[model samples]
Target: MFTPVTIETCITFHGHVCGGISLGYVLANYAMDKLGAQRGDDLYARMECQNCLVDGVQCVTGCTTGKRNLEIIPGGPMALTLVRRDTGKGVRAVISVDMPHGLSKEEAKNHILSLDPAAICTFEEATLELPN
Candidate 1:
């Protein structure tokens, strides 16, 4: 379970709390739950954007850039796919929530946290993609 304390740790590691991280946190936890993933497991994450979301996933799942298990591919919509390298099973999450433009960062974060992760994003089964 990625609890509020985990979000606090992610915020400290990320330098601030924002909507992106909160969404990422929710999505990451949802995906992890779907895949039965635990922190420090042989997990691989493919992120579809370059932003705060990456930090949330990294902190929550213990998959890091240095570990070469987190890949950030820019130019796509905000999405994340997490796979267990051992079984090639994974889940893809694409954000579906829409926040108004005028909300403050805290408001945005809280708005994201208040909803169910499935309400904030859509999830589907996926297979790991790796280049030879």
Candidate 2:
């Protein structure tokens, strides 16, 4: 059965650049779509996820126009969540990809090593809410 889902993600960048927000939004949307497709589901028919990036300066100036570069964590595992909505039959799933800033190979390795694997596992497990 076809169901309706809405997913919204907001990312904030702290720098002077253009299109970072929009780029992030695009990347996020693409990631979500890909995730859904891989799971044998149609994203267009069952889900709606919107991505938004906001710059610090433009947010303050209220200009509503800015471009910026986005640094996404590459080669990391993507997170997916499926939540049941109030309609009782509808489902919403969110796919999140963490794009870290550009780092040297060594630095990136070290950063990953520094994280607590157990915590990461817990967070990943908590993202999903299936229908009853």
User: Candidate 1's residue-wise lDDT over 2-74, tens digit each?
Assistant: 3433777878888987887887788788888888888867789999988888888888877789988889998
Backbone clashes under 3 angstroms, per model = 0, 11
TM-score of each: 0.90, 0.21
| TM-score of candidate 2 relative to the true fold | 0.21
Tens-digit per-residue lDDT, 15-129, candidate 2: 3322334333333333334333222231111212222332221222121222211122233333222222222222222323343368653454345334443322222112223
Q: What C-alpha lDDT, on a 0 to 100 scale, does residue 68 get in candidate 1? A: 86
Q: Which predicted model would earn the best lDDT?
A: 1
Candidate 1 lands at a TM-score of 0.90
The stretch of ten residues in a row with the least summed lDDT in candidate 1 is 1-10
What lDDT is reached at residue 119 by model 1? 74
Instruction: Show model 1 residue runs off by greater than 4 Å.
Output: 1-5
